[model samples]
Target: MNKVSKELKTGVLLVNLGTPDSPSVPDVRKYLREFLWDERVLDIPAVPRWLLVNAIIAPFRSPKSAKVYRELWTENGSPLKIYGLANERDLQTKLGDQYIVKLAMRYQNPSIQSKLDEFQTSGIKDLIVIPLFPHYASASTGSVYQKVMEIVSKWLVIPEIKIVNNFYDYPKFIAGFAANARKHMENFDYEHFLFSYHGIPERQITKGDCHNVCKFGTCCDNITEKNQHCYRAQCFETTRLLVKELGLKEGTYTTSFQSRLGKTPWIKPYSDDVIKEFGKKGIKSVLAFSPAFVSDCLETTIEVGDEYKELFEEYGGEKWDLVESLNDSENWVNLLEELVLENSHQK
Candidate 1:
């Protein structure tokens, strides 16, 4: 009797937005140029966009942003990369010995192409690509898919691939986020819980409008099939789930967007404005959460943690606490593991 050969296996790819290789001006410039110039990111004509990015933004902003990133950088390097590696390790552990788990940055080093090559070379038959963005956006999750497909399309042998666009409303994800919030809040006194997400240019939002439903407030206030893929709507949904899970009242918590670039109108209830509002309202203690990002990066670490903290204090608020990100937390790891396993079985 001929022996049947065992199949190689399935794998999971966890992709994050990414960070610069180092917290230096040149590195930040290089990273920003690639990130900002993407048609999906900028969503503008080439000449005006080129003039804006190359002539104006990168030259001036790179130096300032690099300083912020330097503060966020650890001895090991970028916190985003460090946490991403940890997530991959913990996820592999939870998924058991049967699955091959890998992590890749959507933008910088250890890129999607190189990691996908590793999977391809390892003879993976079924692949699941999970972009770490909790909410779907063309600039974030969709960009990852584009890069993944760009690489896989070139391979002589392409594996069956599955992409999870968003888990903003997933029960496991909601539970994990709430649990983390509760864990942190247990030890502190927070008068308010703020969900601060990364911002994308408003033009990007309107262009990728799977439905013409995102008017910023009226549309995202009510999530439905029409605006299901809408970035603004999904972010609101994430906040809603967490608020429900944590039993937070309407006035007790709020959501906002951060890290907007070029100033052309990104999502609103901007973090800066929110911080000022909190301070002005005499809300002394605040706990901020970055739901858009699963792993902490410069946006969450420096932008939210440092910049917003200072802003809050400057505006008269006392004791602003930015909740630590879900960086390989046991519950979060298990949540991701289950997500992968359940999706893998579906294939």
Candidate 2:
């Protein structure tokens, strides 16, 4: 190895699914309008897309989603923004001044373009991009990659980029999730554990089908060789790992998807429907986990925390608890440091 006088500037970029700028309806409308209308996200044509998003989806969905965001917003702001800032700070501390850590949202404020510019201006030559989606989807991780490439295309000097697609199988990542769930379980008497993740439209899933695999039934059943990159498979993989870590028995726990938009089919079983079923089945106490998201966001905080809580309670369930996301947890920060080092070595 040659020793050089210049320090190799490496950037650690943390990307999340994103949230509205505020809890207001208009802001949520803007956020969703962009998020749902993405060709990569919806995987649909433009004409029906415009009608679906603007005329029907945005008009009704925004106000309802905004109310959910209101429940999630704190005095500071969205929990996603709050925890994203904290995660960046903690990762910076763990990385020990050798790397620059920048956080951005896939949908809204502090966009990928602006963050990459900040990193480029600061002389970062090597980059580690970690999309906070624990399970990778073309719509999520691939979208981030597209945005990064789009921005870097304009820059005079392009940094070498390494993307962390999914940490679903990472030991430390699994441990952080198990530990968080265990902490909440200690206080609450929960009879069932539910893992709920953001739902991507089924059309989006098929576009990345890789082969004829991932028919969304027995197709996603096997998370092995050919279908490993499948987003649905990875979500199941996360559940299996967490279940093993927590010593959970089969049928005692289940997984589902949340936050479906428009009339099209999304990956399922849906979280809202599952909660109702639990109530009908006499499952009294339940604990919900949103492992798809590494950091607490509007989806986990409001969609799972507040909205699901109300649904569970309304249906006569006894106790419902949502596990806190890995927001600046020591294990998470250390895991991130390891991820950066591993990727840098690979380069």
Candidate 3:
């Protein structure tokens, strides 16, 4: 590291998708409006998006979504937010006093703009931004990058910024997940495994693929220059890395997409279908991994762990389990520290 780089104060900003402040219908409605209203998420004209979000989805879905959130919430608060705060504190300790660390949510309280305000006032000359999703997607990581850039563009004295958009295949990250899975493996000898990542629309995949190679088959078996930024390809790549690290056999495991919304042709091989197939095929035991997320939130905890478990069991499948997310683990903290130091020196 150069002397000048060492002297300038650097700020580390960690961000995640925001959650509803509470499980109440009004709170969930507010969160859904902000989340679905994002152009990148809904991908429609302003009028259609506004009408769909305000007039239809939020009003109709908010109450039911609020019910699910009620099941997922705990005494402390939202697990995603809880873990984000924990990661901020641990990463700060890991990096020591030389760097400043702050946590932000892309939508709700402690927003990206507000956190950047603190960095701007602190006279930081360099900043490192790490979005908490492992796999890169336009709705998640890309939205975060766009939000940060849009906010920072207005600052009078913008800092040099380095963004770690995604770390799907980072060594420590891969190991942390493998370790968690191993802990589950110690007790149960599961017969089949599912690597279920969050689903995005098909257009998002094609949008990132410049070479028109995202046929969603062997095209994602290996990452290439064309499919490098493709969300589907990256999800597959993350599964491949986890399989290699965990020594999971080819036929014994399946990579599928979950949390599909609106039924607009998301990536192929949906997770619920795969689970049913496993049950019909007489696979008695199963283990599920959600490597796309770093923290346990509504998607991982309730969606994957709770709802999917019920679906799997309804088909006569037995012993379904979801390997917990990294979620403020020591290795996860170490991974963030490494990302900050490594990127801080580069930009």
Candidate 4:
């Protein structure tokens, strides 16, 4: 390994799914406009996507979504952005003066373009980017990479860029989730455990199944060379690993996908249906975990924690506890440092 040089310091960019700069309707609308317009996210043809986003989704959903974001806003700010900033500070401290760490959002304020500009001025010729999604999805990790490259290509000097695409199966990741879940489980005798991950449209998975390998079936039950990048497969693999480490009993837990939008059929079993089924079965208690997210965003905090719990209770269930995300945890900090150091070696 070459000795670290102050002039050639590595810039570490930590990215997460963005939040509205404020919880106001106009801010949420602005955030949604940028987020939904991303080709990778909407994945539909440009004309219709533009029509749908501009004419329908953005305007109608914005005010209502603003209310939801209000529920997620913390004293400091949006929990997603707040925790992302904390992660940047902690990782910078942990990595010491040799590395410069900055946080960015794929959309909205503190954007990837702005962060890269700072790195450029700082004279960082080497970069390591980490998208905070555990599972690899075109809309999330891929979007971040595409945006970064698009920005840096205009510069005369392109840094040697390395992006940690996904870390769903990293040991430290699984361990961190397991530890968080155990903390919640200590309070109640959970009758069942549920692992719910954010859902993407089925077409997105099919489109990315480049090798003709994704069967939309048990083919994704195990990770292989063929389905390595399949988002659903990677999500299931994360659950498999975390379940093993937590010593969870088979049949006592189930994995489902959540947060379907405009529904052209997303990955199933849908989390709402899962909750209804548990209610029907008269299961009174459950511990839920959102393993795909590394931070407690609107998805984890409101969707899984609040909405799901309300639905479960409505269906005759008693206790529904959501395990918090791996936001700014010591394990996560260590994992980030290790990932950066390992990538530094590759250069």
Candidate 5:
């Protein structure tokens, strides 16, 4: 059989959690209005979710978030958007002419709907989506997948679409993270390391437990068919892989969750609390890693780098450093190319 023409084009859409177009309160409010309204995010009845977001969360939270975002913003705009665009450009170049690469924000400008429209007109025969999140969570990767399908379902002639649900265990992905963290450790002789991931509500987790096996205990200690898709399990497994690769002592490194919202319980051993405890225990310096995000954004840049560092220092701890994310780096772009090529070859 003759090989498919290089011009037959496979479309690649790289999606990220998104950012406000600007750091102003109004822009931040607009961004939060769209992000928190998603059922996958807040995960409540429509009426209550609307009230919580519009009446309370957006009104109160946006101003504070906007300030932090302003600190993270650059001349080019949001770090998330900037890195995302760079990755798109580099991946397109690396993948060569046969592939059409586009980047989309899950909640803001350059939306999935618009990108899918572009792909439809381009006459592509196949589409591959890689959500920038390393782990699979209902609020992140799952929501992106749901949104993309919603947009494409109406098309009369849909392309062969494949979505990458999770790449937490991908060697290159893990290596990229380890490489970033090592760079930081090499500069500072930190006493401890923390792998802090974005937190999700516990209820959201139980809903994904098909076999009713997620008790938030040893059940998640090992990944299995029962909880293969469990968010917490994947997080633990990711930490484990990184721990081994970095040769971290068993007790010296810990896994914690960050960026929690609301009064309701989230994943336990919260990152803030962990840091505070380390402070009280007189642990001086520590290196923090946010593996949940592939790009440098508000969470890793401000939340972990600034807010948490201050909190730790207030409690008498000395240095707290946040390892930079894998945004647009050569290693990360190479991983994206490999991911696209591997997914495209799958039957």
Candidate 6:
């Protein structure tokens, strides 16, 4: 890689997790195959991962997932893709013609391979890769980073690549969430608040340097140099920031994890359990926040808003309202602009 010249155009790639092309079994199956087959995602050997994802999970899960996708679809299309594409287009206009801003899903259509293919010959000497995940996780951000490098490395001459990591602590990022949540919290009469982040396998946590510092108890309460990259710790840090930013008391909000798969235990305080307990404890009227997701997709829109809401209501809770993600919000667009300008010119 050579040093970038001042006049060189910068290519900004904003990568989201992804959604199926349509709410169809075949399309959903295809999406699942590409998503779960990743080594970073499935985290199993080649043959087993292939057999499990391709032969079993994808084939069976697609039908059920397609139904959920159908429920999640809007008049425009998949909300994740819609919001992501809008971010890309608007961000390009905000950045003007000086930079080429494009959006891609890590999994299905608009795949990273095809997107990087454009930048491969776009005459851009500098490139910025921002995985849209707020926190650093092997399955999410790490997978995006690996896939990007794998493709870009093959280019005859690679651009001066700069892949930005987690923005968990970015002020504007937190402010965006806080601003969105405040609109819902204006009433501020709810008995409790829940911060439900996407869960990862607990083994994935101890699998990395986090084993040195993370006990997944009090260790996650504070972010340290050793455990900084720990997904669990970063999740807690996000919760801490939101609590302070929103002026909520310590005991008022609880942090939990959702969307766990398989039988093995995931990061603790599972969201279902927490919601059930909130009802069992007779706590009603709760506000839920999913900071793990920046856009309203299946996880946020259906899972958190609908399914979880039903669970809470069934368990005796009166209300379970979810705070929307920062989907194409002005605050988020501002943050994206800062990310591009601040890193694109680095020494």
lDDT of each: 0.83, 0.85, 0.89, 0.91, 0.90, 0.90
TM-score for all predictions?
0.93, 0.92, 0.97, 0.97, 0.97, 0.97
The better-scoring model by lDDT among 1 and 2 is 2
- lDDT by residue (tens digit), candidate 5, 1-347: 13665448889999998888899999999999999999999999999999999999999999898988888889989888989999999999988888899999999888998999999999998999999889899999999999999989999999899999898999998899999888987787889989899999999998888899988878878799989999999999999999999999878888999988888889877999998899778899889899999998888888899989999899898888888899988889999988899889423
* Residue 237 of model 2, lDDT score: 82
lDDT per residue for candidate 2 within 263-335, as digits (tens), equals: 8899999999999999899998899999888778777777798889999999989788899888878988888
**Model 3 weakest 10-residue run by lDDT:** 338-347
Which pairs in model 5 have colliding backbones? none
Kindly report which residue pairs in candidate 1 clash with one another.
none
Tens digit of lDDT per residue, candidate 4, span 52-118? 9999999999999999998888899998888888899999998987789999999998988899999
- Stretches of candidate 6 above 4 Å error? 1-7
Which segments of model 2 are wrong by more than 4 Å?
1-6
Candidate 3, position 114, lDDT: 90
* Runs in model 1 lying further than 4 Å from the true structure: 1-5
Clashes of 4: 0
Instruction: Report clash pairs, candidate 4.
Output: none
Q: Evaluated with lDDT, which candidate comes out highest?
A: 4
Candidate 3 residue lDDT tens string, 103-144: 999988788989999999888878999999887888998999
lDDT of 5: 0.90
| Steric clash pairs (candidate 6) | none
